[model samples]
Target: MKALFIPGNSPYPIFSHAPLATAVRNAGHQVLMGGIEWVLPNIASVGLPPVKISPVSMEEVGAFMGAMPEDPLDQLKAVGRVYAEIALDSLERLLDLADHWRPDLVVGGGMFYTAPLLAHQLSIPSVRLEWDRIDARMYDPGAESVLAPLLAELGLDRVPEPDLWLDVCPPSLRPADPVPARTMRWIPGNPQRPLEPWMYTKGDRPRVYITAGTRLFSGDALRDMARSIAGLGVEVVVGAPENVAAELRDQLPDVRIGWVPLDVLAPTCDVIMHHGGGGTDMTALNAGVPQLVAHPEYPTEATRRITEFGAALLVDSGGQEAVTEACRKLLDDSSYRERARSLAREFTELPPPAEIVADLEQLVAARA
Candidate 1:
């Protein structure tokens, strides 16, 4: 059977979908991943056949969405609208591809609204893959509000719910009321580079890995955080995109600044500090590294759950003192590491991607 996988426009969510898509394809079924031009490289990196469904990049959509609001609710609304706009822009091309490809199933990333619409239009099953522990449906109200007209245009009242929702969140970090989903282990599929000795090996000093994620962060803030982390007598490795790494090269002569793959770097680190993007957060958690998240509550549910689980701490500001104190606390207090390792153990107990694929086949066969 043929399966079409549609992930979010951004690189992180696309990475989140890779493990399962690869699993399905390895099971001797055809898999085609659809994305915008901006994320084609990310799709290709996962060794999947990519079909570019839209010329627009996520940066263009972010420009359309304008400034992100400080209020988390408004931020969710804005994010919802952004995904809706992406769907609106790509729907035609997506439908055209669907007509030609005729996939028996469509597996969508958590926030990619277009996947459900495509499945509904084609009368096929759609599966929703959670990018993290959070229930992504929290953005639905905002998305559906903007999507109403398009729904009317398509003669549908609402986007159909997926036949299966795969949850990759560890049970310990899951929200009190999560969407009903099948538990699947989150196998990190972070893009890799040729590894050097430093990446895979740990030094005598405690090692800390800091990343702002693909969404990017101000170099000044990252520099301050790096310095603060370094002051604690730990080795600091700053993982960033090329541009950010270039900006930091001279400023942080003593620190390691480059694209260090999380799957490789995270295991060696004593602690992880990042912007709290779902992929980064889950990666460190899976690696059993205690985290120092910069935001107080952006990805609401996951942020709240992780802190409450005592695996991570929230740094309210980018102040150097705050960064140092948080990192020090994560390093000094052993409980955080214990909790993180507990979550990592939970991940091992969950079903692997291949098992999820077998279950998916059964679901599809029953429907057929």
Candidate 2:
């Protein structure tokens, strides 16, 4: 069978889709990926399967970003609008690919609005692969207000729901509002690279892993947060790009700095600190490591659920003092570690991606 995987025009969504695509391919199905050009390099970097780039340009993405309003609600609406626009822009290429490839199934990233529409047009079954629980809101009440015009252009009345929704988030970390979802074991799909010898070695002091994610980039606030964490008398390792690491190096002369995949780094650390990205949160959960999330703007559902589960602490401002205090709690408290291990046990009990492949095959066959 041929499966078309549509990833969002961002690294996170692409990363989320990789392991599942691997599973499908291993089950003797052909997998074809689709997305914008900017994310293609990152997808290749992570060693995802070959992709067919959409006609959407970087300039279009830039314009979408620039047009975002200051209000959070407005920002969300704008994002929805852009998602629709990208879907519209790529409609022709995607349709052409579908005609040639004749895929039996479509697995789409939650935010890649084009996938479901195309699948509906072709009368093929589609499924959703979500990065986190926030995807539950994709079809919420006001979604039509943002998506209707685009759907209308395609002669679609509404964004058709996928035949299945793949839930990677652990039950303990899922959102309150329930949706039609099937739980799939969470697999850490961060890009792999050569690991340094020191990464495996235990240090004299407690170790802490800090990252603001790739999108946070660099700023005085982030640098100060790193500096303060480095000063906390613990062994500090900062995961960032070379340029960001260089900037942090000026402030933190003795801290370890480099781009190490979270899957490799999480097991070695006592506490994990990050920007509350779903990938980072799930990685920490899988590693059975406690977390300190410094998410000022968008505190994800995973952040809230993890904190409520007693495995993580949230720091809203990304302030030095707040993060330091949270890190201290994570290291000094035994309950945090205990809860994290419990969560990890729950995660392990879910069916692995390889096992889920059979289920997906059955679903496709039934639909076909």
Candidate 3:
């Protein structure tokens, strides 16, 4: 079997999709990753007028998006427009790949909405992976009005045949309400690292892991976040390029810091400061390190569950005092560690992602 994947712009998909990709290859299916460059032609599906805000400039993008009603219905209109933009910009290239790869199935993460169309065009079954359950009404406030209709239009109205859906989410993270009579399988890979290997120590200096920097990161706010950690006698590890690091370094010379791999450094740190992307959340939690998330616009279901599971602290991109205080609370109190550990216990108990991918292959085959 030959399998192809459609990826998105964010870094999270690379990690989330890795286990499944490897599993497919190991099981004798050739896997090819279709980078988002193919998504260009389909960008039209996301109408530009509704997607008034631009991805190029993050500062202007948020304020512009904010002006639109925060209601889910309005958000839906905006997201639809944005998705269409992505489709118009990338779809042609997506279909063209089929001519060569001749994949048996096209699997996609929902972030790139055009995958369904690509599957239809090529006359192949499309498998969509969801990190979290999709419940229209259960979203943060104004979600249902917009999300429900979109899913329906996408053919989610019917239970996918032979349980084609692979939802890695466990019962604890899933909403109270579920799609009735739909048999969903849990294929888990979001793995965990034991704390025995990674212990948290305050030492004479505090160690803080800042995941996302101001590339519209609330630049001053993130700088303030660094400052707050420094003031508290803590060391900061900011993961950014040389220029940004150089700039920030000029501002704070003495606080211990460097740009290192998340896998290596996150385990050594006491707490992680990030913008709540899924990979970072999973990595930090699995390492038994608590989180401080600066909530961003339009966080997906995965982001919502991370906070609900008590693995992280939600801090708005506001004043430094507030950001500093949240960091203090997480570092000073032991309760945050307990919550992260609790979630980690559950995250690890399920079957790893490799097994899940193999199960998905079986499911797809059964249907065929």
Candidate 4:
């Protein structure tokens, strides 16, 4: 089978789809990445080479997010309008790629990358790929629910028949609030991150991992956190990307700072610090370490939500004082470590990635 995959908005695609692509490729299918042209660095950052197909420029979507008048509702309305425009642009590109790749089916992870619309335009089946509960149920009446009705009004069908709305989030993680059942499915994700060296080789002192990712990687806060923790006599392994690490490293020269892989670094560390991307949350849980999170909500929605569940610490990840205090508290508290381990056990109980992939493949086959 050949598939053209439309990716999510954030860097999640790199970790999420990059591994998924490798697995699908190993399964004997050709997969073409379709969202790279819009967010090129995101593709390049994750080390995925350019795919043959080009995506509609994300400039309009960026502009749309930029030009929206501050209100959340207005921003959402703007998104749906811009979604239509972007979908049209994506359709033109997909049509051109189809003429070349001629994929067996088209699959997208998350919204409006034009997969469903593209499939609609090309008379082929398409599935909306969901990674978070928010995107999975964003169409209902609650916070962040606006896209479905708006899309319906625009005459674009958001629903896929024969039960096609699907998600990668595990059902055990679903909220108590009512959720849409038809379009949802449990799909576990693992990027198979290369484990870092320091993890397997334990040091005399306990280990702590720190990263705010891109959303709220305040240089000052990170440096203070490092300095505060470095003095605690524990070995701190930070996997901060180049941009975030530069300033933090300058402040905490004593701390071991480098681009250690998460899969490798996470399991080694006794605890972690991150802004809470879903992938990061899962990684930390799987590694069975305590987490300290600090995100200010724009791109931090995933972080903030995960924090509310009590699985990790919602450290302010902001001011020097907040970072310092949060780190010290988590380091000293035994309860935080206990909760983290419990969450890791639940994450472990979830279905493996292969079963999740089979669910999606089955959905597509059943549709056909």
Please report the candidate that would top TM-score against the real structure: 1
RMSD for each of the candidates: 2.0, 2.5, 7.8, 4.9
Candidate 2 residue-wise lDDT, 1-368, digit = tens: 88888878777787778888888888888988887887777677755565655766678777767666776676666677667777777877877876678888888887777788888888888888887556535333435666677678768787898888888777877667768688888787776788787787767888998885633425566677667776778888888878777767777778788788888778889999887667787888898999887753465565677788899898876456767988988899999999999988988998887887876788778976
Question: How many clashes does the backbone of model 1 have?
Answer: 0
* Better-scoring candidate (lDDT), 3 or 4: 4
Instruction: Kindly list the per-residue Cα lDDT of model 4 for residues 83-110, writing each as its tens digit.
Output: 4455555556668877877766666665
Candidate 1 structure quality by residue, lDDT tens digits, 262-281:
88888898898877777888
lDDT of 2: 0.77
Order of candidate numbers by lDDT, starting with the best: 1, 2, 4, 3
In model 1, the worst 10-residue window by lDDT is 212-221
Pairs of residues clashing in candidate 1:
none
Which ten-residue region of model 2 has the weakest summed lDDT? 133-142
Regarding lDDT, does 1 or 2 come out ahead?
A: 1
- Candidate 3 lDDT, tens digit per residue, 127-217? 7665334432232233224334544775664223313445555456665654432223333232234433223444555578886543334
Cand. 3 TM to true fold: 0.71
